[model samples]
Target chain A: MKNKGDIFVISAPSGTGKTTLVRLLLSRFPTLSFSISYTTRLPRPGEVNGQHYFFVSEKEFKKSIAKGEMLEWAKVYGHYYGTPLTFVQEKIAAGKDIVLDIDIQGAQAVKKKMPEAILIFLIPPSWNELQRRIISRSSDSPEEIKKRLEAAKKEILAAREFDYIVINDVLEDALKELVSIIQATKARANKRWPEIKRLLQA
Target chain B: MKNKGDIFVISAPSGTGKTTLVRLLLSRFPTLSFSISYTTRLPRPGEVNGQHYFFVSEKEFKKSIAKGEMLEWAKVYGHYYGTPLTFVQEKIAAGKDIVLDIDIQGAQAVKKKMPEAILIFLIPPSWNELQRRIISRSSDSPEEIKKRLEAAKKEILAAREFDYIVINDVLEDALKELVSIIQATKARANKRWPEIKRLLQA
Candidate 1:
């Protein structure tokens, strides 16, 4: 049997402070390893191949799917995106905690496979604030922004299904809370059996 | 609508350092609280009502059951043992996180009622070690110890159903990990919505 690693899936509306919170979490806990998705989409300006995504060709992406290699895959913005199960498993085996910034659908899929993964949904304070944040992203036009806002409402509702709901109200405080949770979950006796045995022997 | 506090059910066979972990967690984090179980057993010397087990009459305990005041209840050694639903609900309402150190059956019952509650199973390093610890407690006879160990094996197997498993290998290290998990779970954007809202407004 494989020892499972805890997966924290942080989901939110595009501009509900998820990226910032993730960045803060990464910097605060260098031990945290972020999961990079594999995408068939072209890289945006200044985006590195592995850092932003594992930019793969359609042929390779298809081959991966044929090999049943991905943990979860979805079509987004006319491109294919997926999480490589092997990459995550390897990082976890190396004793590093990994975070998955994914959509609710992807999160659910991951959990269905690994039920121990923690699903954390980030919500905007309110519909109005979510609306404002979406408009500010500047990656979309007026019509596109409206579509995103509409999608966000459904996504926020999806938050109800998540394991925990944290509002991105404050940056530092939210990040601190996350750090505490990761540490706390590991303290569990079942997860710490080997360590506990070692400690008791010590 | 109630913004419920997270319910953490912590269970372990005797002498796996569960009490030490909980005590350390409570002392270190003021936000953490313990759920005090209520029992219909007569109070021993120096035991106070409500503070220790909420001492009550069998009639009163049965009345509580009729009123649905208990979250989970069991008759043990001619005594009724249970958790007061009202006490735990009140603490949640007041925004205090509560930890329940209960039996496996109680944990399952509570989880069914509050599906959001996180379940953790604590274990000793090994079955041999668990036996040694129980024997060392000086509170049970060899026969009683055998019964407990036998029961523990059943409980440990059932732990596979729990959300997380923590080994009580080293008290301090195990406590630290438990602290970390609780921290991360609470920090989850889903759970921290209120704080996130307040922070953005500030």
Candidate 2:
């Protein structure tokens, strides 16, 4: 029998460096897997069927949600996005740590279903820095950038509920802290109990 | 204002190599300090005052306990041993991580008073290994060894309440895990909030 690996539910407002941190972490922890989300939106060019996301019809997504197979789902810009419950459960049961990069609302949903999931909120150094990062990316319009900045303010307030709040001030330091948190979780009492017992009895 | 360092409350049954692990950990982390307990028992020859323990009269120990200066105190074999609250508090406030090598009961007491304290329980590789270690010490009487073995069983039950459990299967692996746990605690959200703010604002 395999011990279930812990889940890391990471959330951050746009420009908190969450994407970069996750990418770096994945590279470092080769055993770690990223949760492949399901989306109703049509796949853009170069997006694989099950790599970037699981592209599904709205009807299929709704059917899975009704069957309680979606861990967390949300609607964005008239498109549906959701995390498949089985994907996370299977990976964890097979002893593979999966990182879920979700929003605050999705994070809350995952926490409610799997209270054992480690909730990490990534925060930028300051509001101004976050705003500057968003603007510098040049991916959003003036109005969209303003809306995201406003949303970041509200999201920062919810960081209090997270198990760990990683400050993305310096990329290296934040990444190190993230690594520490993950390593520590793997050594938690519940996860180590079986090994401890076997060690004590051997 | 100084950010308080994290506290580690470590408990292990006799013969689990807790002492050696703590010693190695201290050497690795220069900022970590071991808590010196105030003992009413007579100091053995070669045991230096204040270095091994603060040899104190029973009356002096009781007085300190009454004044709420003792973080956790207990009587073993008709002698009183207590951890001084001020010593630990001062060290932590000075940004020094403090390790409390106490029994399960004392660990519980410390946890109650300092809710943020991280509790770790160390487990031996095997029952035979634990027995071998205790016997190899050649200090305990036959009856004393038997009594200790019984206590170890009870101590293992309390491992459930601890935050992390390090299994001493291989000395190197256990020591590394211990270090990771301490480093992770220092990087906890509450402890790192200040540094994160400074980094972000820099």
Candidate 3:
């Protein structure tokens, strides 16, 4: 039998450049799968139905939660968001490593449901750097920027709970660390058991 | 305070090309320290006193073992070989990572004495390939080759107990995997706790 794949859950505070890092990681590892979340919110102009998210009506989303189909669900700004259990299970069973980019709360929820999931937390170099990144986004008002900085502080404290931490000091360096973590996981004894057995018998 | 460095214990069966991979790894990572072993056996031609092996008399070796200064020691072919504990401790305390290349029995002993030591086992790709490599060494007689192959089989079985297993198939690929394991260990939560604390306070 093929060895089961690993599930990596990545979480970071706002303005930490988590999205950019995750995008680069996925692009580099073609075989690695990305876990798409189910959302009740309407898709943006560029978002695809299945590729971006499994967009569903509020009624359908609630039905899935009641049926226990959602692996982890949360309501934010009156819109429901969650991971579907079946997709992750099927991919992992087929030996496909999957990456999930979510918030700290979502990461905790995923860990509770799937204890095998590896949780990684990303952070900026310093509080000042985080504030600079947030304020530089002209789209946010001063009040929104202030609120984001406050949230970033609380999220930074949760870094202690993560299995691994990647400091986003230089984009290239952070990417290297992230890649190393993924590659190292594949060398775990449990994951390489099948090959070990074959060699022994041969 | 600086984070205490990690102890990496690498074990491999005979003819696995472990020596080449380890030498390359040390050259690539200049900051990593190699744990020099003490041996009662006389040094081979051109071997340096301190750089190759700490050549000492049986009296000195036994005294160190009695004082519990030896981390792990074994008597092979009527000669004593062992690792010194104080050197390892001092290097780690000074925030320097150390690598120990030894046999499976030595690796197990180090793990028992230092529970945090990471044990990595290296193996050849296949049984046939292993035999080919061993026979290619013209120095060994047929009887000696047969004995060595038996020992290799026993060591291969011990790979299951290791924390990581690296297959020495292609030299370059194996080196990359070994390097990734070292880099990933540095990102463990406990190692990065100090940085996380500074970020939280900031």
Of the candidates shown, which would achieve the greatest DockQ relative to the real structure? 3
State which candidate, 2 or 3, has the greater TM-score.
3
Q: Quote the B-chain TM-score, candidate 3.
A: 0.97
State the C-alpha lDDT per candidate.
0.79, 0.87, 0.91
Could you give candidate 1's per-residue lDDT for residues B1-202 as a string of tens digits? 4456778898876677887778777889787778888898889999888767788899999999999999999988899999999989999988778999898888889989988788888878766778788888858788988888778766776676677777677787667667667766666556655554453454
Interface RMSD of each: 5.9, 3.1, 1.2
| Model 2 Cα shift for residue B59 (angstroms) | 3.2
lDDT of 3 at B119: 92
Model 2 lDDT per residue over B43-160, tens place:
9999888988999999999999999999999999899999999999999989888999998899999999999899999888778888898889858799988998887877887888
Candidate 3 local lDDT, B147-178, one digit each (tens): 99999998888888898999999999999999
- Candidate order by DockQ, highest to lowest? 3, 2, 1
lDDT of 2 by residue, A1-202 (tens): 6678889998998888888899999999888999989999999999999988999999999999899999999999999999999999999999999999999999999999999999998988776788889899868789988887778777776776778888788999888888888888877988878866665555
Report the lDDT tens digits of candidate 3 across residue range A91-156: 999999999988899999988988888889998998888888888864888898888888889888
lDDT for model 1 comes to 0.79
Ranked by DockQ, the better of candidates 2 and 3 is 3
- Tens digit of lDDT per residue, candidate 1, span A1-202? 3345677888776888888898889888787899999999999999999998999998899899889899999988789999999988887777668999888899989989988788887776666777778787667788988888778766766666677777666777767666766766665546655554453344
